[model samples]
Target: MNSTLTVSWRSVQLLRILVSGIFLVAGLNHLIEIEKTVSRIEAAQFKGFAAIFGNLELLVILSGIAMLIAGFSFMIGFKTRWAAIVLLAILIPISITIQVGQITTLGPLFKNIAIAGGLLFFILNDIKTIKKQKL
Candidate 1:
């Protein structure tokens, strides 16, 4: 058993924690400014199915809460795959409605896409780990 290998593994875990920390901060910010966030979502003109839930603001609020839950779960490494999936689900609509189009929004659009890619990478890595364990 190489001590260096053990150190490298620990370093990887630390990086994962750091990555999850970003989501934790984002989630907390959404929760702290929930009313403002919901207002912004409404301002974004999110219509259609979102309206079916009675009030769009409530749906937006719920989505923000979901993000917070997913972020917390990811930070704690609890059902990380499911957490990533939930985050991905939340990101898709946001990327489509808020981040897409407009030259001014392009940067955030790409950033969200990159974040989704990171989540996908985590998911694939988990699948690989499960497969290895079964073999």
Candidate 2:
């Protein structure tokens, strides 16, 4: 491939690493700081959302596991689209529960939105690539 294409490809990989790193750290935080995470969730705008799962602590743990697995998968470019979808699924509710409604959380809310956009990149890019491959 040409230099520009090679650079572009490397940049894409770098972006994937950076994006997945957020989740990897967050997943570790969720597990390492379970009580803190739970406390924050409890303090969030959407208390009822956590209650829906019936066990807040368990939900946190499961979410952590999901994030860790999906994040690593995304970082390695394994099932990239599926990993992004999984991360996106986890992100939406968490973002809504924690960052929505509170004016103080505007930055975090937008940050999550930007992260969602990144994940969407993988999802859409893979779709296009897969279509091309099938031709």
The global C-alpha lDDT for each of the candidates, from Candidate 1 onward, is 0.65, 0.85
Write candidate 2's Cα lDDT for 1-135 as tens digits. 633211255566777899999999999999999999999999987977877867889989999999999999999889989999999999998987888857675899999999999999898774324321211
TM-score of each predicted structure versus truth: 0.70, 0.85
Model 2 alpha-carbon miss at residue 92, Å: 0.3
1-135 in candidate 1: lDDT tens per residue? 633211244443454566666666766766677777666656554434344555655656667688778877876768888988888887877666555533465788788887887788667664324321211
Please provide the root mean square deviation of candidate 1 (C-alpha atoms, Å): 6.6
Query: Cα-based RMSD of the predictions, in order?
Result: 6.6, 5.8
Task: Give candidate 2's whole-model lDDT.
Answer: 0.85
